[model samples]
Target: MYVINKSRHSAYLLHAHIVFVTKYRRNVLGDLHLDAFKTSAAEVCAEFDAELRECDGESDHVHLLIEYNPKVQLTKLVNSLKAVTSRRLRNQFTDLRAAYDKPVLWSRSYFVGSCGGAPLEVVAQYVRNQRG
Candidate 1:
């Protein structure tokens, strides 16, 4: 079972499945390439007191199943993850920027879905299967 660190004031537990696309929706992340980025994203999530259960994606977008403390603002967590991963991926893989034809690595918008009451295993499986 997945656990989230909760305090007295915050009883809510959040399991989020988030997705962000590459700039202009370019297909830059192949299998091997995305594995490295997923590894880095997991590290970033862990630093923020979140657990990255699964990280996967196609060429254009990334999908993450994350469990975080309710006290932490959701928007803040998403912003931090996106910013850190984008910067790191851009630096490590210059080809990503070039393929997308932009100085940035990811697009501005993202998709975040909330899971509550459902089994974590079920949610995680759904997130792993997301495409496009």
Candidate 2:
């Protein structure tokens, strides 16, 4: 479940579903790097006063459910998250880095969408829903 954040001027519960894929669609992520990746992403979120509520990913891409302040620009957050996480992940896993032909870990493109109105659980379920 998620909670609302309130300040002197406004109360909000803005959530962004962010997806980032590996460069050239390389399948390099594995179980060993997941925890480290999550910790690094959470740290990035903290820098911008956002909360990393949920994070999961397949071998080639990742999904982040982040609750953020309205004052934060969504694009900058995504860029930092990708930059920080990729740098850390690459630094931690030398083998994984060599596995890719390019030095960059992630691609230039990403997907981000906001959730609203519905209960937190429903929105979360929608994010976790599988595409068939």
Candidate 3:
């Protein structure tokens, strides 16, 4: 007789692709060092126990697709990411503050979407192609 194992359930995963834009669409993130900023953002994601799938953006906005555990709070994660990135960017690049034309690195609002049961590779590709 063969027995079935009903308790072997797959873990619940939540993939979130978030976009944080500068206030008033200012081009504070210069093209010369955009890659570095993306790297910093990825690091922040890792620190929060999230998989940084992809990070990309123009001078005015950033797009990040991250895979996080279901137990984490979405709002808390976003806020921490924004705070850390903003502080790091300001300290590393002084010109960013001057070019910001505002007191904030990221706008007060953000865009977040939940991707459930979708292949992570597909979501990563979409984020990577957001520049186009």
lDDT of 1 at 90: 78
How well does model 1 score by local distance difference test?
0.80
Q: Write the per-residue lDDT of candidate 3 for residues 67-100, one digit (tens) a residue.
A: 8865568898899888888887877787877766
What is the lDDT for 17 in model 2? 94
Q: Candidate 3: list runs displaced more than 4 Å.
A: 1-10, 100-103, 116-132
Ranking of predictions according to TM-score = 2, 1, 3
Question: Which of 1 and 2 is the better model by TM-score?
Answer: 2
* lDDT by candidate, in order shown: 0.80, 0.89, 0.78
Off by over 4 Å in 2: 119-132
Top-scoring candidate (TM-score): 2
Query: Which should have the higher TM-score, number 2 or number 3?
Result: 2
lDDT (10s digit) by residue, model 2, range 25-106: 8888898777888999999999999999999898899999999998999999999988888889889999778987666888
Task: Give per-residue lDDT, candidate 2, residue 43.
Answer: 95
